[model samples]
Target chain A: MSDKHMSSQFDADLNLVSSKVLEMGGLVEAQITRAMHALNDFDIEIADQVIAAEETLNTMEITIDEECSNIIARRQPAARDLRLLLAISKTITNLERAGDEADKIAKRVKRLAEDGSSRTVNIAEIKLSGEMAATILRRALDAFARLDTVAAAQIVRDDKAIDEEFRAFVRKLVTYMMEDPRTISAGLEYLFIAKAIERIGDHAKNIAEFIIYIVKGTDVRHKSRDALEREALS
Target chain B: MSDKHMSSQFDADLNLVSSKVLEMGGLVEAQITRAMHALNDFDIEIADQVIAAEETLNTMEITIDEECSNIIARRQPAARDLRLLLAISKTITNLERAGDEADKIAKRVKRLAEDGSSRTVNIAEIKLSGEMAATILRRALDAFARLDTVAAAQIVRDDKAIDEEFRAFVRKLVTYMMEDPRTISAGLEYLFIAKAIERIGDHAKNIAEFIIYIVKGTDVRHKSRDALEREALS
Candidate 1:
């Protein structure tokens, strides 16, 4: 009940929360990579495993979130500390979404197997999308762990590249569909997979923003309002 | 400084931020609806018109985002205010993306005009996609402005529907491509546009989360993280 005791306990609790978030972040990264591998290899073994792994990732998200919430409520953290906790909470959504998108990738792999098509695209296309996603997941987590706002800002940019690559592949897949109606169904499934991968990149970017939210303790919303006001002023 | 001066200033600033977000939100909705109209009518005129309007939407995005950042820095909002500001910032990203997706719809129409093609799937698919996007955007923005957790939660389900609809279209588009390899290029382009629209849905879902962040003051990351963890645990 002493003030000194209370302060130390609070400090320990904060450390525990950070460690928990980092732990979950690692799991999310692994899941994203596994899902990407499943996509590239169309390895059902991996696909099934990734699909199954999502449950663990989901559970971690919940536990970590609850822990953070309980701390905020109990400790009533303010200013920088509060921002850090809030960031942890928001980042988990991004992590879990990345996981869900991975599930979609796994689902596509399972479907691709079911379709029984041997034909493959450049694989480069799929690989490019997958790599972009993997990069974002990795960078976002690193920036988050470090509380590196600079790095996180850079990470969101990577999404633009992934997007460009995904868009190009979609165009190619559609062309393939036009070239041979027979390949349309098979190609379309892969296209869906690619779309999911692109989404992983987006979720990663959202995760990166949390770093900015935490370190700067600034809301990014002003970026939007400024633009709107300018229009009205004009 | 007098308390009266401080309180009045806060009111003035809050009004400025909120109004700007609402302004941008309205344009986002209109642009998306117009793009849908272009597709439904296969009306090149409307499509061309949509293309013309894109600059407006894009400009708004940049301006609104900047305003949000400025406001956040000045106000230093916490908890609900912080969430609202952050949500406003993020909402613009979604709106801009939705605009980008809509712009694609316009571009596709232009392509149709240039290529001199007729209806491949009629207007039903386009109409359906457009309507879904419009609905999601409206609901997402509304949830944000009102900070209505229940409404925001509903947007997530709506997003799932959008995903389902998009998947159906991909299948149909694939069928068309298989029937004619020559049509693959154009068919794929259309499908790519559809994917962008689906992405817009995802962004709206994200904005809905922002609403939850504002209302519950609990980071929703765990909402997703727990799901993954449960999957992992199970």
Candidate 2:
């Protein structure tokens, strides 16, 4: 192939790579949302679906990573392409971590379903978690697709809300456990679910960081995502 | 100057640069440890000390970055020296993030000193956090001083410990607030402090990743740090 043809081919491959990453991001985002939904309603079937989805998300990450490495090695991309590859690489890490958190939630749901906690914890506790997970997952995916650093940075505050929800969930669970000794095992496992959901929020923030890095070539991990969001939105 | 004389002079400058980075790492390590203590006791004075130390850490990071940049411009090092410069560059990023986490913890401490909780919520909480921070801090500094990937990889377990502590602390704080509405504000702030410390542990992990990169010339952030530890150590 001519040089121009080869350049177009590489660009096409890079585009393919980006779409795959975003696709993986979408899968992870959906997996967490489904897992959250499953946890809230004790829908073992939905939870199982999320569990099965984990393998897909994991494989997509590996695929996208391989593609990125191939492009870097063969195409020797510079500047923006380099940023894109690096961001995608980091996004894989974030997405994989998110998938892990989703799996944990799914496993917690399975245990909770088996343990039969219908009469123990209130639905309000679980719903809050599901809602927060859904919101963050959507924002994380949105940021990735748009390469929207500002939107991604602002998504960090969503974590604060998720943290609040987890905080409230744990409090309610612990109180129920303390009040009724019968609720202890269920409550401990329930708190684990809440922790997993919180982790999903963290990984979502990690996704947002990938978006920021891709768009702005800046890494804002461990920075105040709230501050980053404010700056981006402004 | 002759080639040999110029090379020695360059080495002298590079030594100064490295020494500053190590010095900065020492300060960052101490700040992390001290922040944990301040959080444990709500020691305003210790928090103040940490706050004061931030300037030194910032200066260290900036000076090292500049020196590295200057060395690259002037000497254009390769192989071992190149690795060292790269390590120094990445280490500066991690150390800066570490300092930020420490600063956050210190700020949380100051708030805790004034309006936050002085009564210990749970001893397990403090013990777990202190141990995690102390372990990661030690390993990261060891990685830099000895260029030991084995030592650096050890920070991964400590990071896991930090994550566990953080999750548990959030649960405990939530439990505390749930038991009584009065504990809400205090529990929330302490939650943020726990979060900051958890982030400090993450920065340490990032440093460990950089160490792996330097030692092996491969980016291994997403790999399991435990197996890496075994490989690097043996």
Question: How accurately is candidate 1 docked according to DockQ?
Answer: 0.23
Model 2: per-residue Cα lDDT over B1-234, one tens digit each: 012334787878767877787788788878888888887777999999999888777666656755665565456555456556655765776787788778888887798679745564554675577667767776787777677777777776568878887887766765665565455545555666776777778878878766766666555655666566665665
Q: Pick the DockQ winner.
A: 1
For residues B147-178, write the lDDT of model 1, one tens digit per residue: 66677777776787888888788767666655
Compare the candidates by TM-score and give the number of the best one: 1
lDDT of 2 by residue, A1-234 (tens): 011334788878877887787677777777877887787678999989988877777667656765665566566555456667656765676778778888888988898898786558775756676667767877888777777777776677667788888877766664565566555556656666777777778777767876765565444554565556654654
lDDT of 2 at B129: 79
Clashes of each: 49, 1
Question: Model 1 residue A13 lDDT?
Answer: 82
Full-model lDDT for every candidate: 0.70, 0.70
Worst 10 residues of 1 chain B by lDDT: B225-234
What does DockQ give for each predicted structure?
Answer: 0.23, 0.10
In terms of TM-score, how similar is model 1 to the real structure?
0.72
